[model samples]
Every structure is written in C-alpha cells, then in structure tokens.
Target: MCSHTCAPSTLLQRDSISKCSLCLCTWLNPRRWLNLQEYQSKKLMQDSGVAVQRFYVAHTASEALEAAKRLKAKEIVLKAQILAGGRGKGVFDSGLKGGVHLIKDPAVVGELAKKMLGFNLTTKQTPKEGVKVKTVMVAEALDISRETYFAILMDRACNGPVMVGSPQGGMDIEEVAASNPELIFKEVIDIFKGVQDDQALRMAANLGFKGPLQRQAADQIKRLYDLFLKVDATQVEVNPFGETPEGQVVCFDAKINFDDNAEFRQKSVFAMDDMSESDPTEMEAAKWDLKYIGMDGNIACFVNGAGLAMATCDIIDLHGGKPANFLDLGGGVKERQVYEAFKLLTADPKVEAILVNIFGGIVNCAIIANGITKACRELELKVPLVVRLEGTNVHEAKRILTESGLPITAAEDLDDAAKKAVAAIRK
Candidate 1:
C-alpha cells in the first residue's frame, strides 16, 4: 500500500498538487459489454479500497429530494446518471442548464431531478438523439486539492496491461492525447506477476506523489490492477482523481468497463447488461455472425469479407453513390442467411439498388447466386440487383443466374459493378 505525508501547514491551506506533468489521460473502449454508468462502477472502486464519496441513486424526484436531505454535507453534487460524459456542459431535454450541478438547498433537488428524470441528455460521446437520464447520483461535495487522471488498460502494442498516470487531468483526455501526448506516462504491467513494485513506483513518480501520498497512490494503482484482473475488465479509469485537502487521493470519478467475452465468468458484469444501449439492427446482425453497420445512402452492399465490403462502399462513393449500409458475410455463411441479408437490404426504404460482390475462396458462389435467385422470386425484388461473382463455381453461379432470368445485372469486376449499381440507382 502507498502512503502520503502531509505537513500541518500544507494541509491547513489545502495545498493541492501544483505540477501538471504528473498527470496523464486516456480512455478505453469496453467494446463487447454494455457500457456501465458512473454510479454503477463507483461501488466497485470503493469496495476495492479505492477512494470514493458517499452517494445515493435516486430514480424519482421525491427520492432525490429525500436522498439530498439525508446527506451530511451542506452541499451535494447532483449528477445525471448517464453512460456518456459532458454532463457539466450538457443540457437536458427539458432545457435544464446542466446535467451536473452543485446544490446546497435540499428542496431544489426534487425540482432538478424532475427535469432530468425521463429526459434525454445529449453529449458529444452519445448518439445524436442522446440517451435518457433514468436516474441521478447525488453525492457529497468535496474540497479537491488536485484533479489528476489514472487508468490501467490492455495495450495491444505491448501485448499486456499498461498503467497510465498524469498530473494533468479534468480536461478532455482526447485533447490531451492529441495536443500534449508527451505529458502522459505509461508503464507496462506483467500479467504473470500483476502490478510490480517498480511499475507502481514509476507511476507514482510520474504523478509526482511524495511521502504518504506517493505510497497511497502506488497502493491504489496496484489495487486497481487487481480489480481489473479480478473482474476481467478491459479498462479501469479514474479521471480527475481527486486529492483531498487532507492529502488523501480519492476516485472522484471512476469507470470500469468489462470485457464482453468474459461475461460468462463475470456474472456480476453480465447482470448489468442493457440491451437498449446499442443499435438494434447491429445486435440483430450479431445474431447472424455478420459484420454490418448502417449508413445513410441509396445503394446497399452484400459482399464477402470486411476489406472488400469497405472497398465496395468506397467505390460506390467514388462513383457518386452512397452506400446504405456495410454488410460483410464472413467466410462460411449459410444460404438462408444470404437470403435474410437480401431481405434486410430490401427492407431499407432508402436502398434503390443492391450490389453483390463475392470473391469466393471458402465461399460457394453458387449458393450466393441461388440465395439471390430465391430472394428475388419469393420477395419479388422491386429494386435493381447487381451481381459480381468470382472464383469457386463462378460459371455455375452465372449459369444459375441465367436460368433464373431475373433482371439481375451482372458485372465483370468490382469497379464495373460499382458503376452499374450507381447507374441503376439513378435510372
């Protein structure tokens, strides 16, 4: 465990960390799992011996008022319990000034909570439509001596976990990363041994922690590493980690995002799943084991492999056409799935033309062609359909298309296929 030394005079004035170079900021994508709300992970941090303030989760205005009244502190921080940040600058759907506020009057908590609850809160990190604030976290306000960033995440380049710390925090980490990357210091952690003494001390030095504070900081780093490993979390972050006037560091704002693949073992994390968090269609695509991302355009893509799907979209754009969506049928897709993909493409009102680009290696071109033929016959395909088939029973696929006598246009290559798709959309 790390320790901090405080002089009587320094603690009196609440002297904070003065240096900025001791800080670093970075954000990690949990990716597979549903992103957890700040309130959700706050307990995890506190339970692991990381510093966290007392807080109450209120689902209703009355509950918020009651919770605020129960707080020992004269002033409390009311934060909208949303997955995305920028709450301080964000506006509520009810036209509230801020998603985060410092309230001294307990009576006002009800009013503020009323405006936030069931209202949409939009932030830069969220979708354009924003997410609804179903609840709020009301916590005691603190006198922060310093605000610094710290985190531990897997580093693909190093093939292991890396601990990052910075003296500069509280601002957008993205800006810090882009404009002043040198300020951030990272140390690689050993998976076999976990966080070593040297790594924690190095991170402590970077944070400019001294005496007991350095030891405490180092100890917290180790515990955080342990937490990440214990929960199989992809990231554990404490942005704007607060150093109290008493010379004690606390996780003022904490985030722990777990890996989705490990959910089978992480039952607690799995229990936090929120299905409404991501795109519904994308979730459906996941069921088919297909790679798909919806976009705004008229031409739809049906291609094998992600690289070719990207190229198909680019060429469509290059030829003055917009791709309606990105659909990549990975190696070994079922014939029924191809038909279903076609159905999905036609389901989009914006899709005026369907472009099929198949480079059959492990894929059977005949199945693809047959699937298209089946979809067209059964669904009575209204839009123009273009097929560009190559390799692995390519002639048989072409012969099947010929026999079907569907108005499906055949292209010789990718570029020619793109041109035809665009032209078909225009016509």
Candidate 2:
C-alpha cells in the first residue's frame, strides 16, 4: 500500500528542507531527473535495449493521425500526458480501454487530437488548471494475455533495494492485495553487494517464471536494479508489465519520481522534464520557488508552516469541506510573498473561499495582513476570506485588515477560522 519511497541526497536550503522526506537528495541537490512521463520513461527503457512500444508524441491531432498512419496500426492508444495514476477511468484517460475512439480515419484522428489537446482533465491530483493535454501520444495497442507487476524500490526495513513481483497486475494493487494476497512477493537486494544468484532464482521461480522467460525476467531484475543505482531513483515500477504470447516481456506502465535535490549531479536526467502535463498553479509556484500541490475542494488554504497547513486541511475536511491546495509560504516571509501566495491560490476557479491560517511565530502577522490588503486592493479576491492570526504583531495585523475594507472575517483560533471558512463556502 506504501508506494512512496525516499531517495538519498544532500542539498543545503535556506531552511534545508528535504523535498522527499525519504530520499537522500532534495530538488536543490543537482542530479538526474526522472519524471513520470510516458515518452521519457519509454525512452529510458528503449535506451537500455528493453522491449517497449514504439510511440510518437503529437502536439496536435493531425500529427497523431499522421503518426498512426506511418506506424500502420489500426488500433492506437491516446494518452493525456500527466503524472497522476488511474488515467483511463480517472480524469486523465490513457485511452487504454475498449470503445476508445480511434483515429482509423484521418479526419477523425485530427478532430480527436485537437479536442484532446485543447481539453483539460481536472482530476483529484490537479483540480486547479486541470492537466492540459498539450501533447497526446499515439502508440500501437497491444493484446495482452496476462500482465504482471515488476518494480525495484527502496526497502527502508532492509536498508537496500527491494524487487517486488506480482502476477496480479493492472488495475489497483490494493484490490489484489485484499483479494489474493498470496501472489505478491518481494525480494531484497543489496545493490552494493549485488543481487545473489539464489535470490534471483527463487524470485523467478516464485513468479512462475521458467524457460527463456525466467532468464529474461532475472536479467531484467538485475538491469532494473542497476538502473536504479545509476539514476539514484527512489522508485521504479512497471505495472501490468505485460507478456506477449511468445513470452516476450514488455513494460506497459512505468511510474518514476526523481530526487529533486540530486539535480546537480543528474543534469542529463533532469533535462527530460516535461511541463506540459503539470498544473498551471504548480508551474507558477515552481517559477517563484514555492512548494505547492493542487487538490480538489473549495476552500483555498495558505499558511506560513507546512504542519499548520496540513492541520488546516484536516479541519476543513472534518467540517464537511475540502481543501483546494496545500501551500506553505515558509518563514521570514514578507508582504510580497504573501501576496503572491494569495494570487496563486485564488487563480483556481474551484476555490470558493480562502483560509489564511498563520501562526506567525517567526513571521509578523501585521506584514501578512498588509499583503492580504494589497491583494484585495489589486486582485479580484472574489471569494470570502477567513483569517486567523495569533503569533507576532496580531494587533497591527487586525488593524490593517479592519482599515482595508476587505469584508474579511477574523478568527482568534484555527478551529474558528476553519469553521468560518467552510461555512462561508457553504453559504
């Protein structure tokens, strides 16, 4: 159930915050980047001489149709480029399901491509500026007889890399764990010590792999572990890693997240980043060097502390409301920083109300209040704003808001602020 793995890195931030809590590196640490993009992922597999589908990325529908014709494949897969999971049935459809409209006809393909490119999938991962379909991939579809899960991830318990294999692949792994838990198996590997032959053989035999396929699987396992070390990857998973009738092993789905801090040493890997599928808010935040993750729900939240931001969201959910985003403004904040945070939070149409919960502590509430006033003076601030300011300079902060004529509701505590924000959205 825990797919999240930590990478190793050493980066010195002003706050020295490690982006990936489990990873050795943070984004600040320069290393290669491995984004969860189909094109880039397939390219990695292709470079390693692994068998994967030949695919073309089309920015327009016309290009998709053209590529489809060139490949001479009647059936094709159209996927919206994104890092989110469950694309097919979820908001970001990979178009792997049957009845997916194929571009057999040139005109139809063009139309579909144009439509998809222009459309946005407002999934739970990115409700703000839903993932835009900037480039659609057109690839030959495969008739998979059986699918398996193959992944090499860091095992904290073993303090090394672990290989996970499951005959139950595709769809939800949790469902498989609940229904048939016996099929999934894990093999520990000490990459520095190299994978033991007996361990590899046992893993292969357990997965029912034999003949040439067993050798191939074992080889792939070794290759994957090597790749993990070479790339300093935290996780590498091929879900429903398929098998052709001829026993040909193919990776169908690949999910990878790089140690952001390792970018310095991994320049070549980081160059593969594709921003086409990212949310607009996230892109904007990255441009300003802010840490933010877009989520569903109506209440937009902004806090000076990460821990407080999470607590605010939990309270909102408990009050029968959802949070729009998780934004941490960090410490030693200023008026301009607070203004920028508000701008990004309000940009999303899903945000019906705004919650400003600042404990202040190291930050002065008066400065944040000034920024809130400035945002109200310049931007729309169409949604109601409920604020709670408790730490530094609370009096001046309240005074600034009272004079701003911002129609803002002030609460002395986080509980009161969260409840008021949720109620504001409901009303």
Q: Which numbered prediction scores highest in TM-score against the true structure?
A: 1
Give the per-residue lDDT digits (tens) of candidate 1, residues 340-392: 88877788898899999999999999999888999999989999999999999
TM-score of 2: 0.71
Scored against the true structure, residue 29 in model 2 reaches a CA lDDT of 19
**By how many angstroms RMSD does model 1 differ from the true structure?**
8.5
Q: What is the lDDT for 97 in model 1? A: 73
Candidate 2 local lDDT, 38-111, one digit each (tens)? 87777776677667777888887678778877777756677766665445554424332321344455446666
TM-scores of all predicted structures: 0.84, 0.71
